[model samples]
Target: MRAIRITEDHAIDVIEARVPALKQGEILVRPRACGICGTDLHILHHGFPGTCYPVTPGHEFSGHVVAVGQGTKGVREGDFVAVDPNVVCGECRWCRAGRPNLCLHLSPIGVGRAGAAAEYVAVPARNAFAVNEKIGAGVAALIEPLACAIHAVETAGRLRDRRVLVLGGGTMGMLIALASRKMGAGEITLADPVATKRAIATRIGIDKAVDPSALGDELFDVVFEAAGAVPALKQALTCVDKTGTLVQVGVHDVDVTVPINPFNVYEQEITIVGSNSLADKFAAATELMPDLQKEAETLIGEPFNIWDFAAAVESMAAGHAIKTQLVFD
Candidate 1:
């Protein structure tokens, strides 16, 4: 099989590797499409921790089941499925408490195990969810990120009849806005510095799209900061209503200071929530596939076949595209 292996820290090589044999409770999938994310970019620039590189780096992907492991039921061979990359330990305190995102062993499939950046991948059968025939392979690739968006909006609580202000216009940010609207937010505004991104947001149902510098005076009941960068997150606190909820969906590797003047948090009575990845919400997202697929088919940008993996990385780093995908032919 043709595979792109991360041979060492900050190094990648495309090689002809022997196909892996699946063990019990796993399934082998022929990779159709996979998307590049900010996390992948982080791994690409800064090598892995403990000097260990990912075996294969693509996590956000979708494929058809070519074979199934023994003891796996319901998911059979030839089922079209989307992969849930999270690999959680069931005995963790957080898992017992029903929040697996905070699990002690939350290493993901692409991070801890080999991933879909190759001609084929083997994943735990339980992590695979069936995708309907109506959903194209490109759109199915979006399920991974949309699941995160779904979980973020779920943490934000009811979107119907509420005012929302979303910060950032990247793939995550855009999907956050789409998910909020799908969940029935009455009024929503998307703010970003990119004119092109803002335009894209408005076309996809955000009530208004504005630059952060030119934000309006309207108060919001919920402010979603999908931009983890300092300025955007810092500005998020100021944009919501006095007693509003603020959900920080974005993540930054470095320390981010939130200077809370005692009076502001106390007097304002604001609620702050930090969101991570999906948990049981993977099932919920699977249920929401109809709407998610509708939005993804239209909102997802172009797909790229990996003729040259290095060029794909270079183009992604250059910001020449939105939602860059690498397909295994």
Candidate 2:
């Protein structure tokens, strides 16, 4: 099998490797499509928390079941599925409390375990949710990020009839904005510096898309900082209306800090929240994919062959697409 591996020294290479062996409750999947996300970049260059170097970097993926191990009852070989990458210790307090994203022992695939960046990868069958093949592999692969976006919106509480602003026009931002619309946001504004991104947002049904500078003094009932950039976070904080909620949906540097006005937070009753990984929304995302399939398809760019992982990474870094993916031949 051919697999793309990133070393501790930040080296990436596609090398021939043995196919993964399935554990008793695991299933071996031949990945059809895998989306390269910001987490993959973190694992490749800087360091993301829980990343175990010398890892195969792809978590947002959909694949066909090639082998189902003993005790893996719900899924069967030959089924198409979208996987939830976060592997949690179900015995942990957070997990017991239904907040598995915060589990004490969370080892996500592509970060802490071998991921779907190869000819084959094995994951717990429970992580695999059956998806309609008609959605196409690229759209199925988006389920993971869509789940995260759902969780972010879920963190924002009520959105019906609320003015919403999403910072960024990347895949996460766009998905977050779309999810906000589904939740019945009265109006949705997506802000991105890139003109193309703004156009894409407009095409995808966002009420308004504009340059960050043009956001002016407008305030939103709910603000989501999905750009994962410090400047975007700062801008998001400023755009939240009094008594409104601000959801931090971006993955910022662990050591990064931004200035905030304590007086404003107190006097204006601003509620700031941090949304982590998908939590338990992966299944919900798969269920909702059919309705969103068309719009989700538009976000996927041309895929690079599995071996061209480096080129895909470069393209993603260059901001060449809303979503960059790797496809299996």
Best by lDDT: 2
User: Against the true structure, what is each candidate's TM-score?
Assistant: 0.93, 0.99
Tell me which residue pairs clash in candidate 1: none
User: What shift in Å separates residue 125 of candidate 2 from its native position after superposition?
Assistant: 0.4
Q: How close to the true structure is residue 148 of candidate 1, measured as C-alpha lDDT?
A: 91
Candidate 1 local lDDT, 121-225, one digit each (tens): 898898899988577787787888888988889888877988998998887888888888888887888889988878778777678899999875667888899
lDDT of 2 by residue, 1-329 (tens): 98999998889998899998778899999999999999888888888888888898899999999999989988988999999999998998899999999999999999999999999999999999999899999999999999999999999999999999999999999999999998999899999999999988888888999999999999999999999999999988888999999999899988999999999999889999999989999999998889988889889898999899999999999989999999999
List residue ranges in candidate 1 displaced over 4 A: 47-52
Q: What range of 10 consecutive residues in model 1 has the weakest lDDT sum?
A: 46-55
Candidate 2 off by > 4 Å: none
